[model samples]
Target: MEDERLYAWGNPWFRWSVVSFVVLTVLSFLVGFVVLPSVQRDYTAGGIWASICRAAGLPANWGAGTATDKAGPLSTSVVLAPAMALPGSSDAVGRGATIALQQCSMCHGVQGMSEANAPNLAGQYPEVVIKQLEDYKHGHRIHSFMEALSSNLSDRDIADIAAYYDSVPKARTAPARYSESSAPALVRVGDPLRNIAPCIGCHGGTDHKLGAP
Candidate 1:
């Protein structure tokens, strides 16, 4: 009995069950990949192989060769370098301050902290500032004032502005102290099934996402 148990393939019942399982699996695959997909109106042009690939939910180009569709709009082109995150030299900061005072202080505030509708820039990651400024300069980001002002700025000038803003401290805010029951559903627990992540996951908690302000 022990030898027979160890050599289960020799048993008629076990062998037949294995064969039955394989046959059923092959039949199911044929039905799903061939029969069902072949009859579908969508797969009529592509034939059997395309039908199989479609039924398996393969990418459109996988069965139809390479895609020649035109690409979509281009996004921001700023690449955050390691040096951008590092604190700037005193001279750079001074130059940036001069530029900011002359050009940016009115909207962004003297210390990069905003008191109005404009966004606060104090203590923001240098990369974020660099990216935004670059975007504005290149016309990737559009705003009447920003596009006009950024168009006149050179690369060095943009770097200096970021350095200046980096030198300023951000305004302090009190910490949140919400009970589990009292906290907003979206804040405490995002709807993951729908692909929405919790705010803290990207914004400002333990998991601080890079380049997220």
Candidate 2:
């Protein structure tokens, strides 16, 4: 009876079950702690996975290049000039509105709400708008679409468009608490091992890059 009980304890089913459990645990640990973090750290064009994908016949432009790669420095000094003399000025607003409708509405949406693939532009700082437009017009920026579109725009046209977008009211939402989730980790304290910078370090709020405003 004791021998039978020992045999039951060491049954093939139990042995296989333990083996399967161990295998699954090891796979999960490797995928979660090792593979996932590596992928996140090296998701850029020069990353390991990017190179592998390219070698396997995937397209090369999987990730976006840096801002420097896309455009040159906006200006030596930051300009705080107001986009428009008066937001309520009907003539300037009307001309800007017309220009936006004709030239910018498709990707940015009516009144600059943005679309599926584009960013919202409504209520953005007028100076930011002017800088971007100027960059697009000059060879500083490298977006094919924006380069072609902005190439023909005069300086006055850019100012008028900036005025219109700045005049629009910004959409507001209740402030979210960051402590409740892990989303703030990258924004607050980036992974030093990966050499990732904090998002808020360069983006405006507590800190900002020069000429960003």
Candidate 3:
């Protein structure tokens, strides 16, 4: 008689326990990626999260790379100078362009072409912009000047910075028209990169991602 009573209680407890476990699991997933604050905001945000998930032996979400995050940077007008040769005829009008020069060019390069190690800031999508700034602020992007430069910038400032650079045109790489007659062009490929490897091949364009802009 006692065993029969215990079995009935165990059946109800097991069912309720299973339901609670499923609910908690769903809640945890929502908090981690969707409804929670841990969502990252960059091209690599998904990668970073996946790395974390894999470490814990979980399957990663496949739809990560393309989820553009454009939540943080508020739209605000920032002054900017002319982009070197953006397709458009003019740079941002008024003090905004000048302010961009004053605040940004020290490292990002002149019109986004500086010799510094920093990545060029022109023509990137706004989602990319917000991610980069967030990384800089949160210490994910490591650099000496990054903290100082990104620090104290308001949301509007971040948006303006992104907008200002996006307007700049690609840099000029072609030689002047006068050089067309006499200038010589060479297409020989370089030696293989520092590795014990096969001869590198080049059909067109530079081996490196480098070129005019």
Candidate 4:
């Protein structure tokens, strides 16, 4: 009976099951202990993922994390100044209003509100607007129309325009359909499997990007 029991334990199915279990355990250990941590680290700003995105011709910083070091020299020189740097004087606002009417009102509304194609500029931070204009002018950020328009603008003109837009109050709209409580997981953590980072990580609130309002 003892011999029979030992033979049963050494059966082909039993042996295979043991081997399979050992292999699975090792694989799980390797994935959980080694692979996961490495992946997490790479998700940080200026990490492996950022490098890969740059190599693939994508924006390395999608408003989250530090920008890649490969940016132009102008980026370093463009100080993140306060929005209030350009005071909303009547003269400056008047000049900006004239410029906006002539060059911008077609896409952006007269009040800096958005149209079908363009974004609303009202209540935008002056610093953010200035940086974007500079980036457009220097070819650091690319938009055919904006580049052409900004190319001819002097720093004072840029500041005036930014101030005018920043001074405008944003119009209130209906609340978004998806509340934070309804989409907590998607809003906060995001889906790692799909490579989607958290929306709030870059847009607003905590962990917002540099130069973002």
Using TM-score, rank the candidates from best to worst: 1, 4, 2, 3
Q: Model 2 over residues 163-210: C-alpha lDDT tens digits?
A: 888888765754434452655788777779999986655443321322
Question: Which 10 residues in a row give candidate 4 its minimum summed lDDT?
Answer: 204-213
Worst 10 residues of 2 by lDDT: 204-213
For candidate 3, the 10 contiguous residues with the lowest summed lDDT are: 199-208
| lDDT for predicted candidate 1 compared with the true structure | 0.79
lDDT of 4 by residue, 1-213 (tens): 866755576677767888899999998766654555457644444654554454455764576467656754544236775654656788888888788788877877788765445666777777877888888888877689989998999998888888888788866654334466776776777889999987655443322323333
Off by over 4 Å in 2: 1-88, 189-197, 200-213
Which candidate number would show the highest lDDT if scored against the true structure? 1
Candidate 4 positional error at 107, Å: 1.5
Residue 171 C-alpha lDDT in model 3: 56
The TM-score of predicted model 1 comes to 0.60
Q: Which pairs, if any, clash in model 3?
A: 79-96, 79-97, 80-96, 80-97, 81-97, 86-169, 109-114
TM per candidate comes to 0.60, 0.51, 0.37, 0.52
TM-score of 3: 0.37
| Ranking of models by lDDT | 1, 4, 2, 3
Per-residue alpha-carbon lDDT of model 1 for 112-135, expressed as tens digits? 765555777888778889999899
Error of 2 at 164 (Å): 0.3
Whole-model lDDT per candidate: 0.79, 0.69, 0.53, 0.70
Question: What's each prediction's clash count?
Answer: 0, 0, 7, 0
